[model samples]
Target chain A: MTRTVLEVRDVQKSFGAVTAAKDISVAVPEGAVFSLIGSNGAGKTTFVNMVTGYIKPDSGSIRFADRDIAGMAPRQITRMGIHRSFQIAQLCNDLTVEENMLLAGAIHGASGPSFLRRAHDPEARDRAVATLERFNIAEHRDRLVPELSGGVKKLLDIAMAMAGDTQIMLLDEPTSGVASDEKFPIMDLVMEALRSTGVTVIFVEHDMDIVTRYSERVLAFYDGRIIADDAPDEVLLDPEVQRYVTGTPA
Target chain B: MRSKLFLGATAAFAVLAAGSVILPDWAMFLCAMALAKGLVCLGIVGMMRGGVVSFGQGLYYCIGAYTATLVANSFGVSDIFLLTLLSALACLLVGMAFGPLLSSYRGIFFAMLSLALSMVLYGSLSKMSVIGGTDGLNIAAPTFLGWAPEGRPLQTALYIYVVAIVVIAGTLMRIYFDSEQGLITLATRDNELRVEYLGASVRNIMTYNYVFGAVLGGIGGTIAALALGHVDPEFAFWTTSGEFVFVAILAGYLSVPAVFVAAIILELVRSFSNLYFPNTWQLALGIFLLVVIVLLPNGLGSLVGRRKGNAA
Candidate 1:
């Protein structure tokens, strides 16, 4: 059996009277591509946030590589090899695409960022450009981030998260802002780039078609609980998942 | 590009140093004071890059001036170099103490908190009678490594010294602004959340920037105090802090050199306006600021060239 990379057991979180996560428990095996499917307030993002250390679970443990990582700051968790892309692309609008990539490389570089070394030295530029090329966004590297299209911004956001030695990549709606026609292509590029590195992928996506196509395992969430957990076909076919998550009558 | 900047800085330093010989003593003194104020403004510019404006940098400025003055008076140590170094060291210690707390704040909270701290210093200094209270204390003319010069020669020596200090400080600041940590500061200003998520500590970056600002402010204050031959509570007053902010806003957060240029311009304009209009000099300064803001929203530094494509 493949080793478990992320193990979430009895995780619970609440916001006042409303429960955002209700004893959510799941174990993600190494190199598995998991897609979280849920309706509007179904705890899908809460799960991602807790795992990425964006939110603290009120109870229970989240273990990554056998170490409990609950309540750690986002940066600490990120340095521990779990990285996430935001639902809305987080980019430095004033900077060019290449500069953004260069910044990421500098931040996650082996020596860490330095006060004496130039940030955009030739080596950093080359590495940034190479990453941009992998995402097929190298052509737009010179353009400022604000000037880029929504699809390009999303690509850049995910690309930046790929910096350093990321073990598990959590993508929060990787293709949310892209045009309908461009979603599959973007996902294909992202998945190809990620899969080649053998990093585990967990993406939160609203598109059922994309989920069915890309995810090896699917999780359906409803009212702060996992309603269905199995392969994509099995989960999609589950009556409760169809009823609550996909809004389809079984 | 680095070589070019180094050459340009060298050329500028040479011209300014050369000016001391030809210019009148009053002009040299004015230039020295303007550059001193520019150093404080440079500190503000440093923090501004991290997306925070400090309204109370005068706290460090006052601390620096007072530290230098107290050391000089109490020990009869009149070396300008030693005084400035001590002033910087004092500010560094104070900055380390306050930086973490201040770094936790952002936007107007940081501004007001810093401003409040400076006002507190101003108030306390105003009440201290032994330190001369509202009248403040006078500083003896500074000597250069045991070589005490009086009259015109003294002013010229001070002017040359100020020019050299500014050149070195400005060059080091430029290098810092282009360094990895400096770019992180710029990125922090743009989107602090993203910076944190990228595995870097935003608080640490902000704290470092704040400490840098404090040191720069201290050095500037020491220079100003030495040039004026006086240390006063007015140095910590809100209006004095506001003037440094004015220069910072006028300079923008772009090029390091633009800061001093903006400072020199403000000094010249204020001097000429005070001479010509006397009563309406404040009105003149206000108009100048408004005009510059309207013409260059990014400040005078934007005119140096759009900072794009890693052109620094």
Candidate 2:
């Protein structure tokens, strides 16, 4: 009885004469690991920006949990339990890792029912520490973000998005630019963490290995449009998707 | 750690109050001026930390002075409390009218626009015959509630300093640095896109920051008017805005209380330079600023808390 958690219907966006996303539609069911894989300039991030309310679409409707979130502000979207991480891993470079989690926890935990008093409540601190430990970076929690390695910073970024009891999470290129050896383990941790939380997850990724490994469904975007949406194997085998990923058909 | 921090503030307050009592008239004057200026600089601190540098505070400062002066002169009203309240209301109205416009600009453009707007006010005041024009209007030393400031200068200075420290440093500054929305302001400064992804509107945050900074500037302007006992278009000049910005950078924007310390030091230096090196006072101040900027990129407060992190 898992419900369709997020639905984007006929969304379209453009910049000047360039169309970024055209008549795009997507539906992510509850607790599913849905992934969109495209090369650079394939409009994946643009679609994400629209869904997160960072950019207004030229036309379309968006809904989450039967609620129209078409043009809602990002803060309102976040308050509705949808949180996102960035492709660049926007760590608070000045603050410690623990402090970053504390801020995220404060944002999520302090919402609704005694929101102001909950700000000074002691439980928020305990929750921050526990979330840090979940990412296996708890030992370095006290260290500044700039001091952490790229992989560790990414881990902390994902950990922050997970701090609140969010039902849906959108991560842009979760493992981009990570050292080759660190990639699988970090993705393993991310997938394992999301699985345990039962959070519906959608992410933009480039690597086919990671996509097939983590996602139940693969969404293929080529020229600002969803060309194929199916099981990873089916999408991988599709002629158009294969042509888009690797030049020329075999 | 929090308790220790509170204790340290208490100790600093006591020492400053005691010094005010023991110092000569000139020293007391410098301290009172510093406190008033420090209170105004809090608005700059709030604005800068939110990643916006303002050069329009002269507008609020002038608003406060003119409101108080007009009331005391024309209405023949002499109640200090009543004057402050009226001036504060005037500042709030100005802020409300200007907030949306100020919120529309950012970076150097915003700074220049604010400076231009304040200069317009300065120009108007300088030419207007209603308030003594360029010569400026004189104001009598206000009686607080009922007690006159003539014989009780120390008591009056201490009382105003206490108010400045408590209201400016304690409440408004606290909201700027420590609130949840405060953290969001930092987030907006660091990465607007990231904050948007987290579900916060960057535009709304900037507007709120503008309004808050304006409110603080208004309060500080009102306090300065009462302390100086004068109203002049000169206070709204671009140079006054520049001085506020310079002190903000010199003190570093890390802690709110640091603005007070920076203001006090600057006023003391100004006074001493006027006394000993009257011919090249401005040159001495310029060189001092250059040295401070070169040596401490984070400002004076960074020297105090260098152990924690780099300049905030």
For A134-230, candidate 2 gives per-residue lDDT tens digits of 8888888778887888888888888888876688888899888789999999999888888998999989998889999899998899889999999
Query: Per-residue lDDT of B57-136 in model 1, one digit per residue for the tens?
Result: 99999999999999999999999999999999999999999999999999999999999999999999999999989899
Tell me the lDDT of model 1 at B54.
93
Candidate 2 per-residue lDDT over residues B1-312, each given as its tens digit: 345556666666676767665777667766766776776677777777668888878888787778888888888877776777787788778777877777767899889988998899999999998778987787766766776667567345545554445443544465446556666666667666656555556677676666666665655666667667777898899999888888888888676667888888888788889889999988888888899999988788776644232223
Off by over 4 Å in 1: B310-312
Q: List the residue pairs that clash in candidate 2.
A: A74-B199, A74-B200, A75-B199, A75-B200
Tell me model 2's lDDT, rounded to 2 decimals. Answer: 0.76
Cα lDDT tens digits, model 1, A54-108, are: 8999999999977899999999999999998988999998888999998899999
Which candidate achieves the best TM-score against the true structure?
1
Model 1 residue A130 CA deviation (Å) reads: 0.3
Candidate 2: segments with Cα more than 4 A from true spot = A112-122, A247-249, B152-176, B306-312
DockQ of each: 0.73, 0.37
